[model samples]
Every structure is written in C-alpha cells, then in structure tokens.
Target: MDSRLDDARGAGRRRIPVALDGLEQWLRIPSISGDPAHRGDVARAAEWIAARLAKTTGAVRIVRSAHNPVVLARVSATRPAVARLLVYGHLDVKPPGPGWTSKPFEPVRRGGLLIARGASDDKGQFMAHVAAVEAWASIGGPPLDVSFVVDGAEEIGSPGLKAVLDRHRGLLGADAATVLISDTKMAGPGRPTLTVSQRGMLGVKVVVSTGREGVHAGRYGGAVIDPTQVLAAAILRAARVVRRLTGAGRPPGPTDADVRNGAAGRAVHRDRLAERSTTCGALTVTSFESGSTAGAIPTTAKATLDVRIPPQLNVADAYRAIAAALRGNDHPRVDLQLNCMASASGVLLRQPPTVRQNVDRACRLAFGRPAASISSGGSIPAVDLLFRIFGRPPILLGFGPPDDGAHGPDERIHLGDWANCVETSICLMGFLSGSVTAASTQHPDSSFSDTLFPHGSRGTAALL
Candidate 1:
C-alpha cells in the first residue's frame, strides 16, 4: 500500500501537462449557466466531466434537474474500511463581461497564468482534484472512497443544485466531504486557506406610492405627498433595524491564533480584514426609480434593498426586523410594497482536531506549508444546505487568490498555484485514507455537535 501511494504521487506529477491541456479544452466551451442562451453549453460541460470519469470511475451518472444537469461519479478504493469522501464542485462558468485581451471562451496561457472565464473561479481549481483522482487510479485507485458531484448551476443562484440536493439527500451522504471551491481569495500560491464561515444574504424590493399621479412642481407640489420622500425617510428608519440585526459594527471573527497559526498567517493580517467582520448588517439601495422630471413630484417610488447578515444572526428574525423598520413612523401616509427576492442563511464551521491535523499535514506535503483558517464576508448559499445534510463542517480548500477576478472581466489563475492545488488534493486523499476515525472520537467542543439554536429553530435549515 505504501509503495502504491508513492507511485500515485509520482504519477500525479507526471500528468500535469496532460491535465492542464484537458482543462483548456473544457474552458473552450462557454458554459455560462446564468445566460439562458448558453444552456446547451452548460450541458456539454457536464457531459465532458462524465466522459472523462467513465473509464476510471466505478460509475458515472448525470442526474437530470429542472435546470442544468448534475454529474455524479464514484471511484472505489483498493482497500475497504477507508473513509468515504464526497467531493463537490461546479461545472458552470459565469458569463464573461466586457474587457479582455482576447475572447473569454478562448483558453490562453499568459506567461504564468491561465486566463479564461472559469479558470480561477472553479474549473481550474476543481479539475485539480479530478487530475489527482486520475493519478491515483493510474497507480491503483483512490486511497479513499470518493464520490464526485459536479453541478451545473452556480452562477445563477443554483436552483438546480438546490432541487437535486433536496431530492437525493441519501445518495449524497458520506463520512466527510471537501468542497473544492475557488470562489474566495486565499493568501497566495503554496499558502492554502480553509474558509470556516461566511456571511448570509437577504434582499428585498420596496415600492412606495402616495398620490394617484405626479403633481406639477410649480402648482401642486406643496399640496401632495411625494413617495420619494417617504422612501428616503423609511430607509433612514430601517438603517437602525439593519444595524441591530447585523450588530451595528464589525462583529468579531477569527482570533490571532486562528489566522497566524494557519496557512494565511504570512499573507493576511487581522487589521487587513478587520472591516469584513462587521457585526452590522448592510443596507444598500441597489436600484431607485421615482421621478422622471425635476418639475414634478412623483407619486410612486421604488427601491431595491440588499443586505448582508452575519453567520450568527437568524435569517427569519432579520427579515422581520427589516419589514418592521420599513413600516416605521409613516405607516399610513404611503402604501408600501415589500417584496423579498432572496434570502439564505450563513455558516459557522467548527473543525475537529483530526481533520485539522490531517489538512495541515497534507498541505505541508503538497506545498511545504500548513493550511490557514479564514472567515469570508461573502456567502455561498449552497453551503447552508450542505451543512444541514452532512451535520459536519465541509473541508473548504481554496486555490484562487484576490487577483483571480472571478465573475469579473479577465478572470485568471496562477499556473504554479493550480499545480499545487492538484498536489494538495492528492495528499489530502492519501492522508485521510488511514488517519480518519469515527466522529464519536472528536472532542465535543471541536466538533459541530452544539446546536446553533435552543429549540426547533430553522437556523441552517432556513438556508435550504
């Protein structure tokens, strides 16, 4: 077994070029899940993954969803009693916006980086795991029992993934899971960070109507109530509630020991990320439409409010607070229409000692450094559902850096980091095979055993 592990490591190093070439081929397809016009391309990306895994995998199946399809594949380890790991990644890429040295879909190697729409966000990062699994299969098989879920819709809020996870919860179960996500920025190359928590989101559109129609400013402006004025006042009142819900100022997050002892110690400092830990929820007016002409007082006004809530806050309570705030002081003067567009709960992960030890060891083997723990201000909605299902913290390993530019123009990934990501995944699989123990052995404080709420409150469940 030791000899086979050694061979797998060597084989993985040898297949770098081939693996990169395959990634380029996949990148050539514009699988933009957000754009309905590119739905066919999304399916093509799923088919590509299925075809790639058909030969070495135990089974490859495409789970059909109302939206884009999800690819599921399994690979059995050579030996039994090894831990089963569910690996998660997305197959869809964000729509490329304006600005580029070349076309977004055209994969190009630019000196030291790969520039493409999905290169840094996911395709490049997740492919590293695939390459590692293939290398393992080349020598013997994966060191651990592996299951892969490469979903198709991530950019457009992942309704398809939500539906699939809801229906097939049993099939997705495993001893542990690692989500190979590059959506967050890490320290840099060779320094990997594991994100432990993320902020949740709640968005609502507020519409206000006063008089029947617009009043001419010169004649009737003073006599009629302006809906725009009402909206401005409501927003100011709601600001207090938003503050109460989010914690007014930055809420405390990672400690000095958590960051300095982890992978991000050298790259990130507490002061650098202090603003992201704000306890106060945000209230942004994304869109405002009211008056068409300056000479008239508009009767109707509309605004889109976007809020980012901390992981510790309750989504339902936040929603209620915002609604009450909107109805404050001027409850009868203006007609209010509050529409909730979307809401998802946040995550606060607790890692067991064994998982943390193995992750650090594996990272050192792959990149000559230990992994870091981080708290993300942004949220991954799917994570809430995943946590509810697994009841364990997902191993969040990221390869993308701050400059990766995911979902923005000129997306890219460092070639060196990409290689290290693949190697890290390989080491992770090998380490977990023999080291993983039953969850019962974990220290109560280290594991995710403590409930987030006292009663039957849908803390994480609200995410689904």
Candidate 2:
C-alpha cells in the first residue's frame, strides 16, 4: 500500500465529524429552486458551500446564472498532476415534501444516519468527495488537479447550465480529462455501484380555469364546474398518455432484483422492474393549487407535472403526446392551459474500460470488493450537456443507500457508508490518475490473462 494513500485515509477517518458538520450546516439552508419564495435561501446556500470550498482551494468563486448561482472551486496536486478532473454535483435540493419526523432543513442524527432533505440525494454524496480531497491535501494532495462545479439549480432541470458553461468555459476547467458526478446511490451498504444511465425529463405546467374568482359555495356549487375536478382529470389524462406511449408493451427498466441487487425497498409495481426502468414513464403532479379560502369554490386550479422519460423515448415526442392528451376536445365547460417548462433527452454512458477498471480498483481498496455498475431510474438534466462539454462520459459514483428516502421526508445518509465513500474517493484519485500500477487495476487474485483479456484484446485498461 502507498504510504501517502494510507496517510490520507487516516486523515479522512479523523475528520469524519468535520465533514458531517459541514454537511449539517449546509443542509440547514433550504435551497429549494422551484419555489420563487425561497430564492434568497438558495443564494445563501450557494455562498455557504463556496466559503467552505474556498477555505481549502483558495480559488472559489460563485457565478451568477439566470436562476441560481454556480459555485466553482479548483486546486492543484502537490506533485505534478497526471490528469485534470472535473467534479459535478448540485448543492440545490427539492422542496421538502410532507411527512417529516422533524424539521426538513434541520439535520438530525439517529444512530448512523444523518436525516435531512439533501442528505442522501446529493449534498452528502458530493461533500464526501470534498472531504476526501481535503484529506488528501493534508497528506500530499491528490494525483489529479481537481475542479468542482457545484450548481444551485439542479432541482429545476438545471435550465441555465449550458449557458453558464458556455459563458465560462476555461474558468470552469475546459481541459478536464474526465468528469465525476456523485448524485447517485449505492446498490446497498457495502456495494459500490456505478450508475451508467439516466432517464430524461419533461416539465409541464397545467392550469384549469372555470371562472374569474372564488364564489360562495352555496351560490355556485350546484351550477358551476369545479376547476379542481378538471385539474385532476387533466393530470390523470397526462399520466395515461405517457403510459400508453412508453408502455405500449412492458416498459424496459431495472427490475426489482436489478435495483442495487434487490437492496431497494420492495414494491408491487404494475410493470416489471426492468420493464419500468426506462419505459415506466412516472408522471407526477409535483405541486398543485386548488383553493385559497376554505368553503369557497376557487376559480382556478393549477399543477406542475413532471414526466420522467425513459432513455428509449424522445422527450419531445413524450411532451407532445401529453399535451394532446390533456387538450381533451376543448369543450366550453373549462379552459385548460398547458405550459412547457423544460425538456431534456436521456443519456446512455459508454464507459471506457480504463475508467471502469480504475473505479473498480478504487472501490475494492476501500470496501474490500470491486464496484458494481447499474442504471438509475432518476434524471439529471445536464448530464448530456456536461458529457458533450467534457468530451467523455461522466463517472456516476455515489455512496447514498438505495432506500435513503430522498426527495421525501426523513431523507438520510448513513455515516458508516459515507466514510467508505470518502476513502474510495481518495483512492480513486491515485488509481484514476494512472499513478497506481496497471496490475493493481485487476482484482488481487485474478490471473494476468484475465486482466488483459477480460473482454478479448480490447486493451481497455492496458498501461500506456
């Protein structure tokens, strides 16, 4: 074992509490991007992370975007860098939904888990990498010069990411040899799973209007049509439209056993798990407004519909189908308005063997086993753009448990798992930088032939 790597691991273990403290402080900020009411909170959260990164890198800056600020940070290796790496993660999180055992923003610890809105989904996952990098710096820094681009609007499709990247190409590290994204989850506690694909997304806003304003329930209840009923009908129609198109037969998606090797919560899904992976267009009305005053018939009901598109279907095609389905013959009883909020295509990552082998090696060093690869059902809208900009597929590695309850109440991350992730992250820098030997890339007991010919002369992980 390399002495420097060993020292870094020691340093990381000692500072586990420090990492938790940082994550806890950041999690307290409710950076919900979807709602206009919390805009100031979102900005505060961005600055909080910026300050933390700045302390280590001394090169942190927050770039203003149309919707939110993007925090960028960079640091060089102690020795000559073997590679330039860009890390992508979001600081923003979804609006805290219902069913909280405690306050959504306030982080709490129970045994080994940290409970908070962004704990499992992204903040904890990404912050693990930051903690790893800082620990490595305490020893002798990573073998790779590192750059971080933590965005603040990932919860809302990252609508302005391309623009931000376009405007600040070199400042954001255009020459990155590879990209790292930690916005995914492990198959299970000890399973270091790599996510290789992401579903696309189509955001639609639906509005149903029956009158100008709310009227007395006694006066209008009998004669007028309720917008809430029409709104519910529209939502149902949109969901059916997606199922009809994406579910022509069985939807193609990860099955129950395939999700982190069945470590996920059991469900009796209507479609097969793999059938649902890419084909189960999970249409949801994320937010809705039916009435303001009690006992009064509201004139309008609005909803924000989020349709997840499987990698196989075009987002545009799905959007059009949903729009047509909700139009519903345009009768005089109700006025329906549909707004296209955002749309993005799904991406399938093509992993070069070197990337896979090195990542496997990194995981094995920290977890006592090789890494597993899986396809995630979730969507990260800027993945395709980030891949295009970086000229390579981003490695989607994360440490959150499969059932962390993200985007809902009681979202949490296990500390034991997170520490393993930090150690793996430190090891990944040395292995991925090509500073670690080629033979180490193979499983310890594997024969030479198996390492070279694992896939028959592809020479994917061969030393240069």
Q: What's the TM-score of every candidate structure?
A: 0.81, 0.83
Candidate 2 colliding pairs: 251-275, 253-274, 253-277, 253-278, 254-273, 254-274, 255-273, 255-274
Candidate 1: tens digits of C-alpha lDDT, residues 1-464: 43455566667777888889999998988998878899899999999988998878748788987788888887888777347777778889877878666788998766566788898778888898899899989987886778787878766556667677666645554545544444565654446788777777877899998867677888976678878888989888887777655433333345444344433225654453444343446677878999887798898999988788877788888888888888775447678989987777877766788878888876766666788776766666667777777777777777875456677766777676677677677777877777422222222231110121112211112212
In Å, residue 55's CA in model 1 sits off its true spot by 3.7
Error of 1 at 184 (Å): 2.5
* Worst window of 10 by summed lDDT in candidate 1: 446-455
In model 1, state the lDDT of residue 354. 83
lDDT of 2 by residue, 97-190 (tens): 7878889899987655678999977888999899988898887677778888888888887878888777766665547668888888777666
Clashing pairs in 1: 246-279, 246-281, 249-279, 250-278, 250-279, 251-278, 251-279, 263-371, 263-372
Task: Give the local distance difference test score of model 1.
Answer: 0.72
In Å, residue 205's CA in model 2 sits off its true spot by 1.0
Model 2: what TM-score? 0.83
